[model samples]
Target: MITIAKPGLLTSVQDLGRYGYQKFGVITSGVMDPVAHRVANLLVGNDEKEATLELTLLGPDMEFSEDTLISICGGNLSPTIDGKSVKLWRSVWVKAGSRLRFGGCKTGCRAYLAVAGGFEVPEVMNSKSTYIRAGIGGFNGKALQNEDELEIGTPSELSANISKILADQIEDKKFAEMQWTISSEFTVSSASKPDVRVMKGRQYDWFTTDSQMKLFTEPFEVTSQSDRMGYRLKGPELSLEEEQEMLSEAVSFGTIQVPSEGNPIVLLADRQTTGGYPKIGQIATVDLSIMAQLKPGDTVQFVEVSHKVAQQLYLDREKKIHQLKQGISLKIRK
Candidate 1:
C-alpha cells in the first residue's frame, strides 16, 4: 500500500487506455507516453496494461505502507527514496515506511511509476484509466490527493520470483537494486530532439501546395494551450486551397487538424470523438510516444511518410518491445 503525500502536477492513474467506446464519443484517456508506461510495468514484472501512476512535469511524494518492488521510467524527475537517489529503468525494492519524492525535471515532461502488483483500482468500461472530464474510472475519476490511500493488487508469478530475489539481497537498511538494468536504447533519450513522422490525413488535399510543403519543412512550437486533448502548435499559418462545407468526422490520436485560423492542433489521448476541421496529417503511432514527451516551447519538425512506411515503423517498434520482454524473462531465469 501507498499513501499520497503530494500529488504533483496532474498525476493520475492510467492504463493503456479506454477503448471500444470511442464510437460513442467517449475519449480514450490514458498515459501520454505508452512506451514509458509499458516499460515501467515490464521492469516491475507486471503486465504491460496494468495501471501506473502517470506523473506529468512534476512527480508525487508518497509513503509506502508495505515493502514492494517498483520501477520508474520515462522523463527524469530525479526520484529519491528516503533522501537517497533511486535509479530509473530498473526495479528497486522499497522498504515499508520509506518516503519517495521527486525533484526537478532533468529531461522529458512525464514519467511513469509501476508497482509490482499494480494499483488496486476498480475498472470502469474495462479500463482503470482516469477520464477526469466525465469523472469515471481510476481513484474516483480524479487525481490522487494527500492522505489518499491506494491499495496494491496481487503480484504475478514473475513479480513474486523477482521479489524473493530482491528480498534476499537486503544489505544495510537502504533500498535494494538489481545490478542489471534495461538498455538505454529501449528508453527515449533526454537529449535528442525527435523528428516526428506523419502520414497524410484524409483532408490532406484540401491544403494548398505551399502549406503542405511548409508542413514538412517548417518547425512547430508546442503552445501553452496544449493539454491532454490536443497540442495547439504555433507555426506557419496553413491555408486551404478552397473553402468547403464539411461534416464532423472521426478523429483518432495524433490527428493533426488545421482550423480556419491556420494553426494546427494535434489531437491526443483525450481528444473528442469527432472533428470537422481539415486534418493535414496523422502522426505515426510509434512517434506518439516521442510527441507526448515534448513540453511547451519545445519545437518539433514533421516528416511525411507513406502509410506503408508508417505501418512498418510501428511493426518494428513492436518487435523491439517483444525482444525486450524476452530479454527480461531470460534475466529473471538467470
Candidate 2:
C-alpha cells in the first residue's frame, strides 16, 4: 500500500491506453512515453500493460505502508528514498513506512513509476488510464491528491523472485539499500528534442511545392497552446495550392493537421476521434513517444520516411522489447 503525501504537479494513473472504443468517440488516453512506462513495469516484473503512475514535469511525494518493490524510469528527475538519492531506470525496495520523493526533472517532461503488482487501479472501458478531459478512468477519474490511499495488487511469481534477488544484491549500499539497477537498451539520448519523422498524408498535394520544402527544412517551436490533445507548431506559414474545406475523418495519434491559419497541430494520444482540418503528415509511432516529451518553446524539424520503413522500425522496436524481457528472465535464473 502507498499513500500520496504530496501529489506533485499532475500525477495520474496510466497504462497502454483504451483501444477499440475510438469508433464510439473515446480517445486513447495513455502514458505520454509508452516506452518508458513499459520499461518501468519490466524492471519490476509487472505485465507490460499494467497500470502505473505517470509523473509530469514535477513528481509526487509518497509513503509506503508496507515493504514493496518499485521501478522508476523516464526523464532525469532525481529521485530519493528517505532523503537519500536513488537512480532511475532501476528497481528499488522500500521498507514499510519509508518516504519517497522526486525532485524536478532535468531532461524529459514526464516520468513513470511501476510498483510491484502495478498500481491496482480499477479499469474503466478496459483501461486504467486517466482521461481527464472526459473525467473517466484512474483514481476516481482524476489525478491523485495529497493523503490519498492507494492499494497494491498481488504480485506475480516473477516479481516475487526478482524482489528477493534485488534485496540480497544491495544489502550493503546505504542509499540504494536493496536496489538493483536494470539497464534499458532503448536509449533516449537520440530522442532528446529530436526531429520527428513524418509521412505525407492524404492532403499532401494541397500544399505548394515551396511550402512543402520549407516544412522539411525549417524548424518549428512548440507553442504554449500545446497540450495532450495536440501540439501547435510555430514556423513559416504554409499556403495551400487550392482553397478547399476538408471533411471530418479519422485522425490518429501524431497526425499533423494544417488549419487555414497555416500553423501545424500535431495530434497526440488524447486527440479527438475525428478532425476536419487537412493533415499534411503523420509522425511515426516510435517517434511519437519522443514528441510527447517536448515542452513549449522546444524546437523540432520534420523528416520524411516511407511507410515500409516506418513499419519495419516499429517491428524492430517490438523485437528489441521482447529480447530485453527474455534477457531479464535469464538473469533472474542465474
Candidate 3:
C-alpha cells in the first residue's frame, strides 16, 4: 500500500483508456502519453494496460508501506526516494517506509509511475481509467489527494523475480536501479518543440486553401485553456470556403477541429465522443505521443504526411516496443 501525503497539481490513476461506450456519449479518459505509460509498465513487469499514476505538471508525495518495485517515465518531474534522486525509465527496488516525492518540472508536462503490480482500482465499464467529470472509474472516480491510500495488485511471477533481483542489489540503500534503460531514440525530448505530423481530415477540403496552408506553416501556441479534453491553439483564424451547417460526427484523438472562431482545437484523450466543428487535419498516430508531451504555451508546427507513411511509422514503432519487451523479458530470465 502507498499513502499520498501531498497531491500535486493534478494526479490521477489512468490506464490505456475506456472503450466500447462512446456511442453512449462516454469519453475515453486515459494517459496522455501512452508511450511512457506502456514503457513504465513494461519496466515493472506489468501489462501495458494496467493502471498507473499519471502525474501532471506537478506530482504527489507518498510513502510506501511495503517493499515495492517502481518505474517512472514520460515528463521529468524529478522524482526522489527518501530525498535521494532516482532514475526514470529504469526499474528500481524501493524499500518499505520510503518517502517518494517529486520536484519542479524539468521537461514534459506529465509522467507515469508504474509499480511491480498495478494499482488495484475498481473497474468501470471494463476500464480502471478515471474520467473525473463523469466520476466513472479509478480511485473513487477522482484525482488523488492527501491521506489517500492505494492498494497494489498481486505481483505477477515476472514481477516477483525482478523484485528479488533488484532487492539484492539495493543492499543498505533505500533503492537501487538497473544498469540499462530503454533507448532514448524511442522517446521524444520534452525540451524541444516537436513537429507534429498530420493527415487530411474527413472535412479537410472544407477550409479555404489559405487556411490549409497556414495550418502546416504557421506556428500555433497551446493556449492555457488546454486540458485533457483538448488543446485550443492560438494562431491563424481558419475559415471555411463557405458557411454550411453540418451534423455532428465522431471525433477521434488528435482530431483538429476548427470552430467559428477559427482557432484549431486538437482533441485529446478525454475529448467528447462527437463534434460539429470542421476537422481540417488528423494528427498521425505515430506523432500523438509527441503531441501529448506538449504543454501550454508550447509552440508546434504541423507537417503533412501521407496516411500510408503514417501507418508504416506506426508499424515501426510497434516493432520497437515489441523488441524492448523481449529484451526485458530475457534479462529477467537471465
Best by lDDT: 3
What lDDT is obtained when candidate 1 is compared to the true structure? 0.90
CA lDDT of 71 in candidate 3? 93
Ordered list by TM-score, greatest first: 3, 1, 2
lDDT of each: 0.90, 0.84, 0.92
- lDDT of model 1, residue 46: 92
Distance from true location, Cα of 30 in model 3, Å: 1.0
TM-score to true structure, per model: 0.97, 0.94, 0.98
In model 2, which range of ten residues has the least summed lDDT? Answer: 172-181
- Model 1 TM-score, 2 decimals: 0.97
The per-candidate count of clashes, in order, stands at: 0, 0, 0
TM-score of 3: 0.98
Q: Of the candidates numbered 1 and 2, which has the greater TM-score value?
A: 1
Per-residue CA lDDT of model 1 for 1-334, tens digit only, reads: 9999999988899999999998888889988899999999988889999999988888999999998999999888899998899988888888899999999888888889999999999999999999999999999899888888999999988898787788889766658887788877667666455799999999999999999999999999999999888999999999999997768999988999998999999999889999999999999999898888888888888999999999998999899988888888788888
Model 1 residue 126 CA deviation in Å: 0.4
Ranking by lDDT: 3, 1, 2
Per residue, candidate 2 scores C-alpha lDDT tens digits across 267-290 of: 987899999998888998878877
Assess the local accuracy of residue 250 in candidate 3 as a C-alpha lDDT between 0 and 100.
Answer: 99
Candidate 1 regions exceeding 4 Å error are: none
- Candidate 2 residue 192 Cα shift, in angstroms, is 6.0
**Runs in model 2 with CA error above 4 Å?**
170-185, 190-193
